[model samples]
Target: MDEPRRNLVRWLLGGGLSASLISFLYPAFKFMNPPDVPEASVNEVSAGKVQDLKPNTGKIVKFGSLPVLLVRTTETEWRAFSAVCTHLNCTVQYKESSHQMWCACHNGLYNLNGQVVSGPPPHPLEAYSVHIRGDEVVISRRA
Candidate 1:
């Protein structure tokens, strides 16, 4: 080919290779150094009304950016805990059949008080404070 045509071919090939290389490296670069994102600073959250949750049942409530497990153990009793498992940060759920909090991620069990009962969890779940304000149920981080 003529010199001009060869130069044009070389430019096109170089441009394509650079684009492909950038496409592959961009994601890895982003994965290695993620952008800083500020988390929501929330101290308290209203889960819902007292009547919304029935006794012997549990529900997951969002407290800021984290999940909070709200359980009504008895007709007049309430409990709130950080739903994250201490072992692997998995979301925990209330197991009514056994009257305990359970992390299915590794079969970790915790009592209603958030103490690690058994399994791979190295620490107890973080306990939160529950308050009854009129007919509403409010959950707050413990000091």
Candidate 2:
């Protein structure tokens, strides 16, 4: 009888600990999914007509859900950069005449080549590889 009583007690204690452990572990397991990087869709980006973009001006294009700045530095050359700011995750605005990328939230400034020349930005802007397909400008990760 004593053996049976001890066995019952042990079973009850083991079950309680197991349940508690599972409760703690389940949430951890649910939150353990690997981090994911946001990817821009390739199909949504097109040439976006050179005639529409004025030289020395930046036009914001809505490609999928991302905002991309299409800038024409010269009549022959077109460039593209992500609107996302390198510092504090703010969106960056292109300053055409100065060819500097400016973040209004702070005093962060970057050169036309996306280099961090001054301000609080620790890194330069992320450059999107761009190319011309006929009259269309293509912006893509593969570019």
Candidate 3:
């Protein structure tokens, strides 16, 4: 091939290689550094009815865009806390047999009061006050 034709071919190959590299690296970078999202402000949320959640059972409810885990420890006692784990933000659930919150992602454990019990969680789950109004379960952040 002529000198000009050879130069054109080299340029095209280099451009394609660079584009391929960028395409692969871009997603890896994004996966490592996820974009930040503004959290929605929520003061109170109605979880459900007291009669529906039996003692020693739990349910996940929506508080804005976040998941709130509500547990009924006794017939007269209910607890609510943020379901997101503090370490990696994994969703947590209540383990009825153990009577604790458990994060399946990392085996993080938390008590009914949201205090970290074991595993990789660095902070306790955010606690919410539970109020029973006429048969409805209401959860709200502490003042």
Candidate 4:
């Protein structure tokens, strides 16, 4: 074709190819090195009213972005622990039949004090301090 027309077509093709390459590489680069996001500093969180959980039962509460497990072992006794399993970061639940925290992902077991009891868990669940203020149950990180 004409010389000017050929140059125009070449520029258009080069621009399109660069745009496609950038579109593909941008996401891959982002996925490989994600932005650094600091975790929210949470000192204490109000779980709920004491009456919300019955004796021998457990409830999961959100502490910042993490899940905190609150177990009412008895009418006057309470315990709080991290709900994440140490094995693979799986969420853990209370098993009333066994009176312990159980991670179904690998059958990891933890006692009332958040101590690893059995299974493949490499470390004990983090324990939190439980405070009873009037009718409210508050959970806080230990110093």
lDDT against the true structure, per candidate, is 0.95, 0.79, 0.92, 0.95
* Native-to-model Cα distance after best TM-score fit, residue 84 in candidate 1, in Å: 0.6
**Candidate 3, run of 10 with poorest lDDT:** 34-43
- 1-143: candidate 2 lDDT, tens digit per residue: 69999999999999999999999999899899767777754544874777877888887777677677777888988777778777887888878767877888887888888888888988877677678888888877533
- TM-score of each model, paired residue for residue: 0.77, 0.71, 0.72, 0.78
Which ranges of candidate 3 are over 4 A from the true structure? Answer: 1-40
Predicted model with the maximum TM-score: 4
Please give the ranking of all candidate structures by lDDT, highest first, separated by commas.
4, 1, 3, 2
* Residue 20 accuracy (lDDT) in model 1: 96
In candidate 1, position 86 carries an lDDT of 96
Candidate 1 lDDT over 1-143, as tens digits, reads 59999999999999999999999999999999978999979999999999999999999999998999999999899999999999999999999999999999999999998998999999988899999999999999899
Show the colliding residue pairs in model 3.
none
Comparison by TM-score, 2 against 4, better one: 4
lDDT of 3: 0.92
lDDT of candidate 4 at residue 124, scale 0 to 100: 95
Ranked by TM-score, the better of candidates 1 and 2 is 1
For each of the candidates, the C-alpha root-mean-square deviation to the true structure, in angstroms, is 6.3, 4.2, 5.9, 5.8
Q: Count clashing residue pairs per candidate.
A: 0, 2, 0, 0
State the displacement of the C-alpha of residue 65, model 1, in Å, after optimal TM-score superposition.
Answer: 0.7
Q: Which pairs clash in the backbone of model 4?
A: none
| Candidate 1 root-mean-square deviation in Å | 6.3
Q: Worst 10-residue stretch by lDDT in candidate 4?
A: 34-43
